[model samples]
Target chain A: MNPRRRRGIRGNTSIVESVRLTKIYGSGDISTVALNDVSFEIQRGEFVLIVGQSGSGKSTLLHMIGLLDKPTGGRILIDGIDATFLSDSDRSEVRRHKIGFIFQAFNLLADLTVVENVMLPMMMIGNGASSAMRGEAELVLGKVGLAKQVEKQANQLSGGQMQRVAVARALVNRPALVLGDEPTGNLDSKSSQDVINLMKELNRELKQTFVIVTHAREAFGNVDRTIVLKDGKIESIE
Target chain B: MDFRLVLATKLLLKRKGNFIASVTALVIGVMVILFNSLIFNGVAEGILRDLADYQFGHVLVSKNDGNFVNEDLQLISYVQTFSYVEAAAPRLGSIAWMNSTEGASLNEVDKIVIIGVDPLRDPKASLLYSTVNEGSFVASRGQLVLGSNVASDLKATVGTRVDVKMVTASGEDAIRQFVVVGISKSPGGLAFDDSAIMTVEDIREITGRERETDQILIKLTDRSFQNELKSRLSNAYAEENLNIQTLEEAGEETLAGIRSGIAFINLVGYFGLLSASFAIVTIMMLMVSNKTKDIGIIKSLGGKSTDVLIIFILQGLIIGSIAALSGFIVGSIVGLYLQSIEFSFGPGLVLEVVYDPVFTLNSSLFSVVLGTGAAVYPALRASKLQPIDAMQHS
Candidate 1:
């Protein structure tokens, strides 16, 4: 390949690329390898599903990609930045500025109202934001279809509503990507379908990238591609 | 972040039980500090006023000659010469035997301060006149005035006859008969409850002593000029061995001891506040542990480590401030209540403890700063929480 064309191909291949990532847990003879030389690429603005049976290293791979965990031996490049070599605070900043996360439990702060939770990230990034930031937060909340329930406390919301609120909070900061770990795990069948459809709609309408981990095939229906992991390694990508 | 503070405040509002407990602890701490200040202020004021009002009269002057007669003469001369000198009176104090005519032989010896005064200037010159509640200064040569406690001990009332025996300047026992025309109390009422007041002529007659007095009481025109008066008197009366005792100097030892006691009380109050800080640490640690999952989520959702730290610390400071303010209010009210009631030390010794407790701007501000400062450790703990580890925490 031409050196310039090779660089271009590598750049276009993925916004995030894991190169020979390995993680070991425990000590001495009891050590277990959670990710065995796992490597993959996730393109920008791509809606992808990472599916696997239990103990398949799927969540571990997602954590490394999210910059929530350190690789034992490997490199993770996020949009050309060498993420593995970043300082703890720098990595955290990268996570904060570039990635949005959704948890299976809809991890909303129980003490905060929906509006406050959505405004939290914007306020924390740096001090001295303009008054218009709040207006932006309300607009984002409205985008997530939570404008009417903006004042509701997190704990008071129904499960489906709470998940939607979490989605709003995630997108409110305008991060480059949304990373969800079984985002619909706690929802009923109908609610689960509704949430996945909303995620898909957001992905298309906002042109924001999404990486969701789910066991339910129906939840992955609108995803452009599916990546499967088996026994601490990528089994297939389709 | 402002939002973090708002969130912290909301959390505090929601957890009303914990919030109350934290505030209560802080209030107790603040009350202790205020109470300590009140007691110290009252005790200090009481001692100062008593010293100023009872014994030391701005300044005291004695002769530089060491000869009783010449010292008294020189003191009187200096008093007349110095413009600042208000009045100077001659006094002779000695242990004397006072016997009743009934001959009960009440062996209890009395110390008689045989005051040889120019009655014209003495009352105005000394604190004695102002403190004399029962009778006027010895009006005639043969008349005497007894301290109230002294009269009560002897079962003698004013207008009764008594024989007073004194060891004169010649070291011989001299006896004289006199009528107790007046009764009075000591200033601030020290233990010297039995004192006999007599004229300079009467004391001179009984002692067979002439032109001699043991001490000279000097009053100054302005108390603030005491230092200048002392220096001038010392220089002018260099021939006589006169020593000047200013009110500020006489009570230095007692005042120092009282100040040390005040310091000890404040130390105790500080210890209480320290324990309250420890209580805050415990509460913050509990809060961090309780909200582990939430912390993890916040971190993952672009929340900086500092944000988590701020939220927790803000909670602690808020609680501390509320508690400290409540304590201030409660302590002041209690101090006021105690001050209003009179407490008796013994018969005829009632003390009205003044409890005018106040929060000085500096002290109050320091307390608030300290309360907030104590939350740092808990905040650091919250900030050090790792996103992945906290997420995995049970």
Candidate 2:
């Protein structure tokens, strides 16, 4: 109710709202709750981290918010719209125009070139295919310092380069929210730091919203806020 | 330029071995079908064409009485005037037992139909004139042309004297003496030039029917006009009760057999192509399974299921189309090679390989359709894959 308090949380603007979000796997006695009525808010342009042990369901939460999976109960709101129960195509539309994802494995299609990988979001969004999309891809790749290697295939890149390429792809559509599931987990320490630093720079210079899930504690020191999970429930916000 | 097609092409091209395997299976299946089409269609057409040329002459008109027919030849004259009619002729026929009076041991032939024809006009009606290998076509009342089979049985030459006789209903025998003026050799066909050819005068003199004609033959410029001509002729002879028929109508039993043969061959071809399509389906299933993570990644990037479907379908269509077109070329080559080989299929049944391979734009389009259609189930399954599940699969 107070604008002053709101200003402190997400600069008075919330871009994502999770209300009693619950995800249960299996059924009856064997059912395991991946997300147990957990609720949280992520603000516009804020860098947030979700941290927990492997079974604590941090990745499940990421998948729910990413629109890649549906929860058994509760709902998620992206940019103030109820996205939890949206139809598959509608969800795809939202995902295309509004959200970006970075996979821990750097899941770039090996058959495609780096530029093609980056061009994917724009193509999926169904704006007319043009050279400008590729030109925009070039600019994003340049931002990730992969301008010269655009022609290289996904497999030709190192772990760090592939992650950076993934980041470029994530930002290619200029999505309102970017989600990463341990984006730096597959990298060497040096490469992991390089990827983290690039994301930090992109968040600052572009004011891009980011919610990255990571077990790497080093990432906690760099983000605006941290949500820690224990037993599929939020234990603390720091 | 579509991203789905671009992705599909890249995927298949990178996995060149899989692509080639899919194409090879499809090509072999389609080639077999095409080859069967060629051989079966070629043989059927050849046999029909030979019948038309030598026996049926595109249309046949038969009378109830084999040895008797019209006195004025008015039916022949009327049909010959039609624009579609190329030629028409009446063949006077009689079943007679001919024995050689010259030999003490009779050269016997039982139940032979001696066809009497006008030497000048019969060439247009049948292939008998062309089959004559010795002597000449029937010219006068004392002359006759013996079929090669008959000549062999008679032990006679072109100049050999033969006695011909047929018993009438009155229990009296009508006997005639004639010299064989021509020996006709038969190549495998409906006519086989087996029946002896005689002058209309000899048949008339023997049968005592001045204008006895058993069958009327008509040659048409366009055989498709046969039905219309048959209708017209039937209407004109509504009271005469003459049996006027198209070649197809006359040879219904043979045509039906041929149709069944084609259907059986097509059934085999269908199974061949069906198994090939299953091979494609398996190939696509494996490809989609292997690319589960890629599908998840794509879905996360906002690629629609329809887009994924289009990718796999395009891959199948491209493979099918290329293989089918190449199959046409390969099958045709094989058909021609088969036609070139010769074999003896016993006595009068020599194997004649005709070369008319069946292919059309429809078949080519069908290949493309078949290729893509076979991929639909796999493609739909690929599209329905859960993004989260796929991403987590590996």
Assess each model's interface with DockQ, reporting 2 decimals per model. 0.54, 0.59
Give the alpha carbon lDDT tens digit for every residue of B1-394 in model 2.
7788788888878888778888888887787677667666665665676677767788998865443345437888888889999887777777777777445677878777788887766788777687787888887778989888888888878899888886654567888888999988755645645678788767877777766677778889998999999899888878776788789877676668877898899889878888888898898888888888888888888887888889889888888888778776776667677678652344442344555445533455566777898779888998998788888878
Worst 10 residues of 1 chain B by lDDT: B343-352
Per-residue lDDT tens digits for candidate 1, residues B1-394, read: 4767876788668877767766766666676777677667666655655555444556765544553764565567766687887877776555667866546555243665555565665766676655566666676788877777777777776777888888776888988788877777753464234676778777776776766676666677877778887888778767656677776676688779878998999999889877877777777677778778778877887667877888887887787667656665676577777678643334433343565534533344445665577677877887888888888777
Question: What's model 1's lDDT at B32?
Answer: 75
* Tens digit of per-residue lDDT, candidate 2, span A104-124: 999999999999999988877
Superposed model 2: Cα runs more than 4 Å off = A1-11, A219-221, B17-39, B65-72, B98-108, B133-136, B140-144, B151-165, B173-186, B235-238, B313-359
